[model samples]
Target: MPSLNKILLFLSSALATAISVLVLGFSMSIQWVETTMDCTSSGSSFSNGSAVVTLSLFDGTMTRIHCPFFGGQDDFEVFPQLAGIGGTPLVLHGLVVCVLVLCLLFSACSILISLYNSVSNPYETYMGPIGVYVCSSLSASFSVVVLLIFAVNVNNV
Candidate 1:
């Protein structure tokens, strides 16, 4: 039978790996940020409707949901504004995605190391407890990086 420590390591690593995958999926598919504004009461004759902006953090894309924005009758005019945003917020969003990717990778490493170490002769060095701890800590560190970058991106955007 496997040792209690081995079993615990295997279970914790497995759970971390699964959670990482689900979070990555959500990051890619779900809308990360959204803002809606009512321009009708802006004391301007031309501004008559609301505007909505949605952001996809994973891809650094900003989408304008409302057409003919600011009471402009031509819908295609706003198309140019829908292009990928540039500058600090864009860089910040990219950083968030990259950190999350790193987090997922480290989580996978931890799970593999746990399985291998538990099943075989656990190495006294990196392949043993050291490997699992390093991978888990790196994963956690990347998660914190992602949060900080995302917060900066949202604030700047």
Candidate 2:
């Protein structure tokens, strides 16, 4: 029984670690960009001349260098602005899916282990000190990671 708990703990910890590393890798590639119209003018012939708009990466709320124009018409030939990661959205979505799957797997395993221990070893004597410690620690740690990841996803959205 104790060995079973240890197995559950090992699995949960390994899964959580894998998920955190993966999320951090994906987040590393993410960047936020912001574009602001510095200036604009209306040409005499109804053809308005707008100042060259620049898009720059946001560095802690501060705009960085100018981003190259993506090319688009914005009511007046305004360049298509950029304000997100260079990587495709599909790539980011895949990474997110991987992280969520890992989280769900760990959460389910933890819950199942806890339930099994409660029913099979209700006497409390059956669970050795090490086994109890490992089980509880793993469940708590993975729960915390889940919460953190959820918060990160919410903020990203």
Candidate 3:
């Protein structure tokens, strides 16, 4: 039964890690859409779009979470003043890259630890489950941070 427990633990940990990645990736993609989508015209009005976007989060039926930053009044308008011409700030892209790197790091670490535990139990101490739980939690926490940052960026937009 311990072996079964270990397998279950590993599987659930894997699932959780996958979920975390999915959540972060989805949020990132949503941000990208907001950054690139044409929102200046031919869409809902600013106030209506903002309200709908905010409500989308609670709808529970939509897979995509829209934000006011995308097409509403905010529209994440950015410009690179130092570059002479106008464009999105380099710092914005840098932040997104940083978040992606962190997510990848945590996901890779979780998978690696799980694989190592399954392959070699040198001490037979059964640290696999404990390790898995910790890794999963860490990844989940990082995911939350990504989500919060997304919200912040949206508002700034």
Whole-model Cα lDDT of every candidate shown, in order: 0.65, 0.42, 0.51
Clashes of each: 0, 1, 0
Instruction: Evaluate residue 13 in candidate 2 and report its C-alpha lDDT on the 0 to 100 scale.
Output: 48
Instruction: Please tell me which predicted candidate would have the highest lDDT against the true structure.
Output: 1
Off by over 4 Å in 3: 30-93, 122-127
Q: In candidate 2, what are the lDDT values of residues 103-133, reduced to their tens digit?
A: 4455455444444454453345334334545
Among residues 3 or more apart in sequence or in different chains, the pairs in candidate 1 whose N, CA or C atoms overlap within 3 Å are none
Residue 23, candidate 1: C-alpha displacement in angstroms: 3.3
**lDDT of candidate 1 vs native?**
0.65
Query: Model 1: C-alpha RMSD to truth?
Result: 5.0
Poorest stretch of ten by lDDT in candidate 3? 53-62
Better of 1 and 3 by lDDT: 1
Q: Candidate 1: which stretches are off by over 4 Å? A: 1-5, 39-47, 58-85, 122-126
